[model samples]
Target chain A: METMLRKREDKIAIIGAGTIGLSFAALHLLKHPTCSIAIYDTRPDVHDYVAEYMSKTLAGAGVDIDSTMQRLRISAYLQEAVLDAVIVQEQGPENLDFKITTWAEIERYAPKTALFWSSTSGIPASQQSRNMQDKTRLLVVHPYNPPHIMPLLEVVPSPRTSQAVIDETLEYWRGIGRTPVVIKKECTGFVANRLAFALFREACSLVTQGVIDVKDLDEVVQNSMGPRWTVAGPFKSYHAGGGDGGLKSFLNKIGGTVQQCWDASEKDVKKGSIAVGEDWQIEVCRQTDEAYGVVDTRERDTRTRSVLEAVSCEEEVQ
Target chain B: METMLRKREDKIAIIGAGTIGLSFAALHLLKHPTCSIAIYDTRPDVHDYVAEYMSKTLAGAGVDIDSTMQRLRISAYLQEAVLDAVIVQEQGPENLDFKITTWAEIERYAPKTALFWSSTSGIPASQQSRNMQDKTRLLVVHPYNPPHIMPLLEVVPSPRTSQAVIDETLEYWRGIGRTPVVIKKECTGFVANRLAFALFREACSLVTQGVIDVKDLDEVVQNSMGPRWTVAGPFKSYHAGGGDGGLKSFLNKIGGTVQQCWDASEKDVKKGSIAVGEDWQIEVCRQTDEAYGVVDTRERDTRTRSVLEAVSCEEEVQ
Candidate 1:
């Protein structure tokens, strides 16, 4: 694992230069400065957009735009893009048919040893590669929004995925400064999205119950658990809660309270369920846009990068 | 609201100088430098412990210890603590009988205008103030653990709580550089804990189901959704997901996927439910302690403070 991680200069192929694909391109350049990236997007204009996006996003992280761009190759043909690739990251649309088609193309052209990684957030790789000739190297490598900044990468493997592929994928992501967690079993939404949606359900329930307004609910999270989770995960946080006794003491003292909270949560979920009504959703979207529209994206990205940098610098110093 | 926020020098009383109470005292001193504090605890040595804790914690936040300590008064008697107080924050143990006894004593001594705030996480303010003569002034002002650093304060009011008290409490918290979200109706766990427990259930389910190791699970959250949430809440994040159309577009495209994830989550919950088994919890605590022991608390607090300070500074500039 250590040796694999030390080898950072892998020939990477990025298929489908959409929003996620573009973000991955920037992330690869910023994280693996020595690696070369080949971007294959069906659209002719994807190269220019990716170039501009990478320059804007990576420049803030201190990446030299011209030199980094020199190592990037934009190919309109799939064979030309992935023929010599060591890792093929497919960030195509979420549709199964489109994914199967893209996977077949990559498997046909890319080197047999190259790992076939999908950026599908929800779909399992097994289903996406069902029609492919070989599926052992195919797996899901889902990332959260703005992959260049967020360090979480869910390296989910299908049943047929080989041990070497999993190990190499993990090593590569770690080498690129990503915190990759392997999903032992294939599950919908994986870990991050499942946890995210769980919280989202309750946030919606609170809004419906008038427990808090949309804006204030956001504030509550941003101020408290947001930073808390950033420093310590839930289990670690509870462990800290127990003083010297650790999680055992915390559970003994407050386990009943957690159960009670869960029980009460069921009632709240029913009482003030998140309405999927179009008008209600539009209103929420309007309010959300009003609060954090596109104009604030640059500021938000900058802040997230600053926090990550601070945390990483602290870790290095320690 | 703006004018009320300007008044910072309130005479405050903190009953029960335990962990939470001491934290509240430190927070008040750090945030409101001019406010005088009176602390009441049954334990005779609480003053020394609180003083040591405050001195150690506040020094990291660049607070002037000597000046802050001069305004702090430790009292063994309840009357002495609440006699002339304008705000009395009660952080007693989670016992109804004991809380009633303490509240009765506080009401008997504290001035009529003093706002009665309970730091109880589970019990509602209404239930706590059931035995009090004047319930109108009572409310719940629950803070996340280590109140001096984490900025979330759930300002939940009982039905009998006066509007003036609510408004003043909001203004006061904001004045102290805290983000307080008002809970419109009394509910168990309120918003933050409900959201927290919601995520915890899934986390436990994942661990139990062999989906991810406890350490890896923590890494997944600490790296991905944790920081993403610190910058933008769920609603706002989804808004960004939908290119220019905002959250409406995001929902329109992926609402069905969200529902599917929720459905899959229900099955997963039943498969690997969070067990409060004593031995299992102990093992988890041990691992957690090994990963993030007491020595790391200072580093954790420093990192959290850095993130909060950076965020607040950005907000001010915006």
Candidate 2:
């Protein structure tokens, strides 16, 4: 019933200081510098690991190291991490049983009103919170990898999730400079992954069908659809393509072709068909590292940050 | 065979000075300042229309107006347009009969060695060149909309297309600051459209399924996968996700989820099924315009150009 806007002094707790959790911590620290954070992980040396990880990745990503470090707290105990928190973000492994156990523990420690957010990309909140006493407090706040750089957060709520919790989560993410889309229904892979894997299925099919090499397929995407989609989504892009006529005209012109192509796409996405060979996998990894460097480099991170800033600024102006 | 690199003074002829043709001309002129261009269109007022279109669009895209104008020439006669062209790029309407007649005229006027490129996004060169005497010189060089800004050029060669033509086309595109990916096999919609539509199908399905709205779905993509894909394609992105273990490890972890999502995507892209309501379409177009402005604005165009420059520079350094 209270205002959905997140307060600057909100105590946020992060569970499981793995790659996703660490990345989330860095991003939260960087964006919400005034907020307090407590990180919890079962690993004995998670404190040292997280401190070192944050120092290296955050500094490389051009964050203010001293302030971010000042705001962060590491706790080996889950209760210590979540007891007084306003928002408890769980970043545990992608197992239903593990997530259910984590949520149950979080529910026991955190206040009934505390927002429970999970970073599960595929597992829905309903399944994750099946064992929890109060499911209304829990929802999925899934982020893309390297969360510090990528700005998407799919805020998926279960059927029993409270309206207030959903509203607060949406505003909370936006407050921290994230573009969060609330998934109306719990779906596997959510929207982002569904769209991504759809394209991937076709890319894999093309590679297997010998229509294009792996490297060339990557090039085709990076050069064309990637940039265009970055500026505008499929609907907007097609709307622009309609010239002055907009989406209607564009669809009228190319709807048939789209259907034809969809029909031509590989029907079954088996493990064998999607596989890009071991050599190709290794080669692509090497090429990717060579191009963008590992994790969050200054160049790659800065570019994404600048674009995000630009988009946000444009939104504010409009 | 003679060093596939394109000379600055290469005479390029542009057929059908419509939207795609004009965009290609602006990009070619901006990127290859010394290249001379001849434009031919059947419309009586095409010369004036194209001239005004180029001046407005190119200037907004931050191109050097004087040089672009200096290198461009408008001709109503087909022979005059194709006479001494090293490359004749046809941007005619997506009509097989129209393309066939146009290519026939081009082949009759142009020299045997002149490379023929069509900006047909759907129609394959083989189909268009059916009526031509020499099909080896003809191929598809499809660019995403607003070709001046988007760096992708799908260089599709038919079975009859010569190796020399393919190589020279690749080099020519590179010389003009475009990323060219050779689509080895001729399939409808080629690579880019096939991938775009695959994603679009899922997007449409999601909208229809009430999982997300049109605008929210666009935000999810532009904020997350868009920027991520801009830096790395799906294969490279997944490879990075695999961490030290690489894509193999990533697949081992989430390949099942990917298959599930792929299965969930809409199998058929029928016109009625894919259609978002007319009101929604208009609302999306209006929102897009408010965000990026209409067509080729200075802000949107410059943003795209800078991103392209940054990517190319990174590639060079790597």
Candidate 3:
């Protein structure tokens, strides 16, 4: 793999130098020790950001920082970045018009055969590729926050995306040490965020209604579902929870309670009814700040890395 | 703690030797190696169940099985079980009538000063203590499944429960190596399950909606929010995700997207509308079984323990 990456054919273009873009650059550089990375960004501080990222992730990269720096080149022009790349990863702005224009220009400049992977959290490939002449190879490969650390990527393809490209995209993410789950159908927010924010909304409601405070809610979750889901997902946990009857029995037994909560959910999770500066919102944020604001993010990053390493390889459900 | 537990007065009674009951006994015995426990249950197989539980958790308990067993005494009568217990932990059936009658009887037989703790998952202390002459000390002490290892104990006090007892209960659980979160107000399902099931219902909707499959959803969660929440709960994560703006900014930024999901949520999480024996239920169960059935629960338990141990002591908030 190292020898193969040394070839010019292995060059990959990164079409943004923001947090996600730089993270993708750093990790990809770490992943393939000999591969070249071309990062394109109009930001004046793009080079400084890359330097700062290197200093933070240097020890973890397990390779010479100088060579990585040598291999990484910044391009002001998008044409220079995608000139001879095998894969083009676009982590540009989330605006729809911006994405359409950028992708169209990327297609015109880059090799026609290059894989177009957009790291858009919410945008679907269908809309992102609308302005492109040939949308055959374009797709959405959305990662969780801090793309380099979190391995999950939502691989969503436009209807025009070729089946071969989808398979290759999944293969590429896996080869890069990512756990990619292909979305069979595209929708807003995808799977993880929809599930995450759904739970978060209910939690907000609980805190607002004075059922439980923010810090206690955090502790309750950390000690319970946080670790449980880290081991197995919802269906697996519910199935195992059912004893012998599986999910059917679990539903029959606990479904009513869940339903009761759901019935009362409207009182808590108002349909997008979060007034940004509301009193409850202010108090909850203050509580969170008091409780968790003390712990620096470095500690969190360490915790995240340790927890991910401990359980990521233990998936029972393929 | 060991020397303190050796006293004759440091005795606790465990009522009902079902799965939860036995697990509680094992962990308590492990937590206080020299403390005595009296277990009472109507099941003829109760002793066998304890013996099996000891065998399973023996290595993890780090105490001599012989000594632990000697300290644990199973009684046929509730009167004998609560004879000289400093605390009475009732893990009886979920039936409300059974709890009301049992608590009344326990109050009559046990020392009037014994701390009353009910391990009822849903039945609140308010309901469980209906027939008790004195409900001052009684409160709901609910644990996540396999109570010994998963350290979450929801310490809920009824409207009548004394504040001193609530504080004492939280301290006791913490001493037993459990992460106790005080539920400020009593509500059905409490904090953890409500948050868990809320997230779970949305996951169900996503799977049923054909947006993602069961196993891939597991992978997505295991890779994303599962590990994330393990580090910091939803509030902290969002607060950090907002860059400099905190959760208020986070709400303003992604609030619209979250609301969009919430608006569409009803079509999926239809007020606990899970048909227990429906086609989706059967198919999902089949998929779960096919995916996770082959992996024996021992593996899951081990995974749960490791993940819990990795993050339990790292709480940023008290």
Candidate 4:
């Protein structure tokens, strides 16, 4: 296993070149230029394809990544990926067995102190690291869809996971200009998805029950609290609802109503299966399909690239 | 039911001066120098106290509503509040019984064609106007909390509700510099809340099941999707996710993954009651409490008011 010819300055091994992984790779290469990155994948073609694509993508976006691209080598072999890397980002198949095998492989090939960060959404860090020899190094660093554009990364650690790994991981993410929220303990789906899914479920239930049409529902959120959620979270949102004193006042006044409503919400959410029926439901599906069809991702990607290029590095520090 | 004279050019009436009503009145008066709003509440003391406190609060915030305050009236009588009003913004109770009774009272005293908008979160326009002779005259115009800050409003109409009512209501909201999304059909919780609640339900479920802590969950969203959501909706978000062609590719490739995740999400959400047993969970709650409590609504309200004030009222004509 031959390592990439680059000086190890916080060496990072990216274990996959999927959407999130590639985004992180590009961002790391651009933002943390000092860090050495080697992408490892089971797919023989992914490494070369992603490397070439990112170089062209960045070059087109006017980002200077020629030297960084030179430093970024793809390793088809696991041992090469682990040789000098201090932090290993795993974006492998979502299958449990694949993860277990990957964990074993990381143990065998990676440095003793290297932290393993899985990008799994639902599979808990505890569950993933159960069979590992040194489970303390394992944690989930789950990023939303496009890791570069979206700043949040959920860092969920098992009970046995070390504080050193958490702190190091936090610094690594922050150094690359990513906002990382550390989960104090291991939990299924960690944070973002749990909150997101909760929202999705209620939306689905409403549509299923013929409450608001899909388009209208989407409009409602986009116009209303969605904008609020942009700047603040649910708690802050509800706090405003309380007026001058904040959430305590809000709860004191309307907490009973919310609690009562919360109790009623249980019976309302008809679970099991995506219940698709009615003309309106089909219309929503069709409309989404049509509207989505009109979207151009390359254009968006280019726009993002152009925007990133136009703005100074310091502008994005926030 | 004696009607009052038009005290000034900027005189307006805000009926049902509760949380929603007072917020609207305070916001409208603070932002726009063109009008002074008179808030009317059935509870005489509430009307007087709110009017007095809000005036002082506004004055403290450096917004001179003194001239507006001179025009401000605290009326216990609906007739007195509605007289000579260009528009009537009603934030009555959501209960169908209470609303119907209030509307009947307002109808007897007010002019036949005063643009009446209801700030009901739930209870559709159809049900609210089922007993009214002139059902087409009324429409449900729901706004997010701290209406001064949030520009989104759902202009929901009943099946029998006229398109004219919808257009007129939208204009009234637009006159106040609100972003209105007209919902053609009336449903439970209108648009924003239904979708918001859906997300809330799934979020609460995830929290209850110990999938994620409340604070970590909020951080992930606030930093990640929340920012994008500020600019675009889920469809646009996914459209960019597709990378090349757009949403078509996302739906074709990762759409299955989303559907699969959605399917699994059904079972994961815990039904009924939230029990926080873990020490980390208690810490999570405390963090959430502290975070929410620290948010200064006065600052937020001021920003909103300034934005509203900045909007060129003449641009609205074009």
Candidate 5:
């Protein structure tokens, strides 16, 4: 009766349906209503919980829950799930040994045309798929925490990954409303966390030295560069700093100092100096105290949801 | 008669009634209604323009204008302005020679008790006050661009700055609804910019290598680290990354990769690379033609203003 029955080839399979995997399946179904999604997990009943959560979320967001659910299915076996899929999103544990074993299995079972992506953050795709005969089809698509809400998806390629695979994966990521930044040259942790941790190391160094308290250190970023960085990156900020002439002018005047300071900051990755001192009693703290921590987290979550909703509704408005 | 009729003991002299100087004066007046503010500038009718702008801003924000203005008074000569002032906020041009001359003159005329603070991002406070006789009282209070809207003020003390001076300046900065993060050890661009640029240098390097484009580079920060950095610095981000264990667990898990990848990236900071190209306009065209050239600049500016406004209001509410 409908044209939908004719195009069943566009299918997605999600392996190891944990938090990241379930989120990917839900989001894929949300974006591609006509495309089917089959989720595989070692544990039973996790799919039921995921399905329930998705239905509630869709209802909360005023989306069509029945239609969204119609495109989603579940399987207990990865071999049966990914046999005819267009893409396979793997979200197994971060342990390297486990990933290597699973990835090799994925390479054996997944269709040749399917673009397989591992949601691993620390492990490089190259190392995981080294023994696979057709490793070029595999890449790392690491998403941030609460993957459904946060938009960053680090698309890192292995040395063997083809250009077409990267381009197709990029298209898939964008189509699903995720902000994907491709790592042309793959390195562990890709770009964001490495750069971030460098700053973290310096902040810890200062805090350890008693230069400032923890709260004040957070304030420094929240009120200062954090706001500016939301709009532009560091290079552009320096460009504006040069006032009229841009980066060249800024470096010409402050280049020596920048270099000197950078040299001083260089150190091998050190362990964190501070440790959580005690376990807190939830009963001792009042509702207000608990609410305070939740307030900031909730606000950030709301902002994220708003951004995603805006992106999804853009076409309708146009 | 009330105590309001009595003359205030503490006075602040603002050297150069530019945007920053005037905003500092207004902010101080808002906090301490009775504190005397005497502004000095070579430019004629500058105070009048500042006064007009402040009135409009205050009115828009539902603040009292005339009463606030009563705390402020402008003078034409530097000597007449700094006669009895306890703090001198120097917002002069960003030139080494100008700063050297200005500091020397301020040291010559101002009382021995007066502390001099330069609002310079480019010149280190140590370098600027190298020749001053009372360099111990000289420090740098480098605020973010458009100082009035931002609350981050980097209080960088020179080698000669006394403990007393730093403490008093910290008190003064806090009294005006501002947060001051001390630079216990001074380096180029202080803390925020140096950390910011380190990331920027890597981004440029990635682009130059054709690993990632300009737009994707921005997306990586926003979706991943940028939003989190708004609430927490890198240390805390990693701390949370540990899931429940905090920083120690996070680093322990990722420590190997961090060390491996620390040396993975090249550390050279060059001018605009071929990836970004010399002209950002042409580079943007190659990356994303729709948002290239003039349209990109306008979009960036609009986004910048929006973020600034959003964060300012959010902080105020908190």
Candidate 6:
């Protein structure tokens, strides 16, 4: 009986069973085969929802369906779900009041050692940590839509989140095959969404301004920057674009041009442009600013090159 | 002898054998085995450069080295190169004056029916079509970068460019394995770069503002939108994000939130933001607009899903 039941420390509590919550549960169940998941939600059909989801996706991957389903426990009571959870992942509604009340409640039931993770895309950990007794372990571990399928897990910590908890967060995500990047500060929209919305703003302007239509704009991106950025980020891409001189050369030659293009965009459309002066360009172009990892731009052995090659090669096959 | 010499109309002349010109030449040689290539450049080491490039790449692809080399013709005189050509791709210096004079000269020699393509990333077709007697056939057919490897070819037509030439340009590029999008009007930075710069600006702001350092920002992007965009463009991604409601639903629910996020970023950073009012959002949220192609967002079967699945699956493998 002892062998049949999962360990006490292996208890993972998931609050809320929405799309993101279900996906996160599925990810944990699929990736960490040995762990047990206790999901708590106010919805009457939470069990049916989980069962239906598992039925649909369980066949795709090589995960042990029956065992995974057996490992999952559905609970109506929040305290019962989080009683001994080693990790508490809340995927509740994006409402701040819901999160504040929920986290304060969770703090009372969850074990002292449990780390709290909120899947909110916008609301920061600081806002959610209002009534919590242990704010150090509370942080935003936002996933790019459909966490089960996406690779990015943005680990954003509030100002009060301790370094040890941050390290623990990183280790947990890394252990689960997630590419987690620690955002230094808790900004609106974090990092990925900010960059995405920024590009999207320009895309909207291009279409409305009649330079190109929405469909063609999408086609251009799917072909061009789509593959380019997939492998390398903007810095690495431009660094290589500079030829031998790297990012510095690229900035020296094209920063002015980028700035000019921005000015043109500004004149025609209201979508804002970033300052692309040598100083600003130089600032972001740094290869070694102490982040998670750094790919040497000179080697150009990035996923960008491989993805582009693969894309074109696939085209050749077609 | 006629077979060995190749046909007159099959002659594709590439003007200026610089990095891009050489890549264009290589792309033509490798992709179109039946067509003969005539490369014109003022460089003394043009032959050596071409030979070295061909040797390095030809082996990796299954293209016959001798056959591809046999179809190649390198010349010092531009007139001799373009005299019998049906297509002339100019990869000259990015100088307006240079393009103006070069097109004027090529106009005098090349066949009147020959379609002229300038691989200028920024200089618009309308601007470069100056000083040419036949502006109808000349337009900017810009490639993303490294024309031989990348897939996107931006086919931007000048206002005076004939409908026939635009069709011919599309046909020529599609015939060779390039995804060519038609830009309705010439704008600075064209489409891809403007979208790229817009994103880059926000990325710089995030770094300079200390929300995320340069390296982590790149990491977050490389993991998130990098793979996301590689599969589907922004509209499709957002459309899917809206779930069954489609793009309209997405704009209805998130457009206001996005607009708010932009305003917040604006308060902190000077980089521009586009209006996300329901009216403007409706304009670009359109998926069926008259463009080259349209992916039905309601289906939610765009490249975004496949790319994300693939990216995560690859992680599983690793």
Best by TM-score: 3
What are the per-residue Cα lDDT tens digits for candidate 5 across A229-289?
6656665556555555555556666666665555544531122332222121111122212
Candidate 2 per-residue lDDT over residues B1-318, each given as its tens digit: 124234566788999889889988888777776688899988989868987898788765566688669899998799999998888999888899999998998899897889999999889999999999988888999988778878889999999999989998988887767788889999878888888888887887777666887778888888887877777788777866877666667776787887677656744234225543433345444554555444544555555555566656665665
Can you tell me which runs of candidate 2 are displaced by over 4 Å? Answer: A1-9, A61-67, A266-303, A306-318, B1-9, B61-67, B266-299, B313-318
Candidate-wise lDDT, in order: 0.81, 0.78, 0.81, 0.65, 0.67, 0.73
Ranking by lDDT: 1, 3, 2, 6, 5, 4
lDDT string, candidate 1, B117-183, tens digits: 9999878877878778988889999999888889889999999999999998988888777888898
Q: Write the per-residue lDDT of candidate 2 for residues A27-131, one digit (tens) a residue.
A: 877777667889998888887898788888876656668877888998868999998788899888888999988889888988777889999888898998898
Please give, as one word, the docking class of candidate 1. Answer: medium
Chain B TM-scores across candidates: 0.92, 0.88, 0.92, 0.82, 0.76, 0.80
- Candidate 3 per-residue C-alpha lDDT over A1-318 given as tens digits, one digit per residue, 9 for 90 to 100: 323445654888999888788888877787766578999988888889888877787655567777678888889899999998888999988899999999999999898778899998788999989889998879998889887788889999988999988888777777777898999888878888889988887898888888888988988887788888888888888888888777767888887777777666665666425434445677787787777654456667778877876775454432
Clashes by residue pair, model 6: A231-A303, A231-A304, A272-B272, A272-B273, A273-B272
Best of the two (2, 3) by DockQ: 3
Ranking by TM-score: 3, 1, 2, 6, 4, 5
**Candidate number with the higher TM-score (2 or 4):** 2
For candidate 1, lDDT tens digit of each residue in A1-318? 455334566678998888788888888777676678999887767767887877777776666778888889898798999988888999888899999888888888888888889999888989999878988889999988878778888999999988899998988887777888899899878989888888887787777666777788888888888888887888888877887877777888888888887787777776655545433455566677777666368888877877677667767866
- C-alpha positional error of residue B212 in candidate 1 after TM-score superposition, expressed in Å: 0.4
TM-score-better candidate, 4 vs 5: 4
Q: Write the per-residue lDDT of candidate 4 for residues B1-318, one digit (tens) a residue.
A: 002122236456788877678777877676555676767876748855785667756666566666657657787678888876766778876688988877777666677767677888776777777667788877787888767567788887777777776776666666656688876556545556655655655555565555565665666666765654544466565555665556456556554555555554566543433422323334434545776656666555554343233222212422
Q: With candidate 4 superimposed using the best TM-score fit, by how many Å does residue B295's alpha carbon deviate from the native?
A: 4.2
User: TM-score per candidate, in order?
Assistant: 0.92, 0.89, 0.94, 0.80, 0.73, 0.83
Superpose all Cα atoms of candidate 3 onto the true structure and report the RMSD in Å to 1 decimal.
2.8
Candidate 6 lDDT by residue in tens digits, B1-318: 223225443888999887788778888777666778899988888889889977765665677788778988887799999987888999888899999999999999998878799998888877887898777878888887677767788888988999998887787777776788998888888898999987876776676566776567767887778766765678667755766555555666776667666666666555423322213222222211222033222112123223334433443544
What's the alpha carbon RMSD for model 1? 2.9
Lowest-sum lDDT 10-residue window in model 1 chain A:
A274-283
lDDT of 3 at A75: 90
